[model samples]
Target: MKLNKHTVATRYAKAYYNLAEEHDCIKEAFDNMMDIRQIFGENPGLGLVLSDARLTLAQKRPIVDNLIKNFPELMQNFVLMIFDYDRMGDMELIVDEFEKLYDHKNRTILAKVTTAVPLTEAQKTRLADVFVKKLDGKKVIFDEVVDPEILGGVIIEAEHQIFDGSIRLNLETLKKQIAK
Candidate 1:
């Protein structure tokens, strides 16, 4: 079987995670990973700087070092490692891989629930409780979002399954049934 991208990312990310854990810098490393992801994702110029062959490590390292000066030393070292390996283009995916490692280590599920309208605090609490109960009392890192395009109701994505009960889905189903 062919090795998938996720597998490759996980392998590299796990190495970083192991190093971060050894240095007792998982949180700092994770946070810096997030920051590096955002910086690379949102700023093409920053990415170009890293990818440019004309820019030597002597030049690039100091620039990046100053930007992440306050982050943990391991994070700084990780940046250098990535730069040395020329894996800067995969920064976002690597961070996502690292986050999965962090979440798995912490026994948490980062959930995302979206509804047409914002749920009340009580509603959020109740839904979060439902997830907690359903997961055999495992922690649910519940996150909720509102999308008016859904028209109404909710679409919850937790673990790897989706629970879609949105008004938009209902209307589509009704339309399909009517067409039939």
Candidate 2:
């Protein structure tokens, strides 16, 4: 059987998660993963450089070392292993998978909210509170996106569900009804 990218990433993520748990450093691992994820996300070129096929481990090690200069020894080693395996391209996916595993273990959910306008801190807190309740009181981690095309209202994505209250969507619905 051929293992796909997701399977490979998940395997690595689980292994790292287990190692962290065994060392009682899950929190530290989680924080480090977030930091690494953000770095990779913000600098796609860095991911490409680390994952470049022509680069030997010796070549990659220095780059990895510089990038993770202040990282905990465990995380630095784990990241180096990914580069060693030529799986640096999958770093983002691995981080995502790790977050999913951590969130599941912690009974938390990540919510993505898109709105036509920027939300105030109070609004964000209220939205989180509502989502927390909607998610059966699980802790909610919110990621907000501003999309003026929505015209008005908000759209939420959580646990494979979409709650769209956007004016654009409502207008489309009304249009369909009028056509009928």
Tens digits of per-residue lDDT, candidate 2, 114-179, equal: 999999999988988888888885798889899999999999998899999999999999999999
Q: In terms of lDDT, which candidate is strongest?
A: 2
Scanning candidate 2 in windows of ten residues, the lowest lDDT window is 133-142
TM-score computed on alpha carbons, candidate 2: 0.77
CA shift of 139, model 1, Å: 3.8
TM-score of each: 0.74, 0.77
Error of 1 at 134 (Å): 1.3
Total backbone clashes of model 2? 0
Whole-model alpha-carbon lDDT for candidate 1? 0.80
Looking at model 1, which ten-residue stretch has the lowest summed lDDT? 84-93
The C-alpha local distance difference test score for the whole of candidate 2 amounts to 0.91
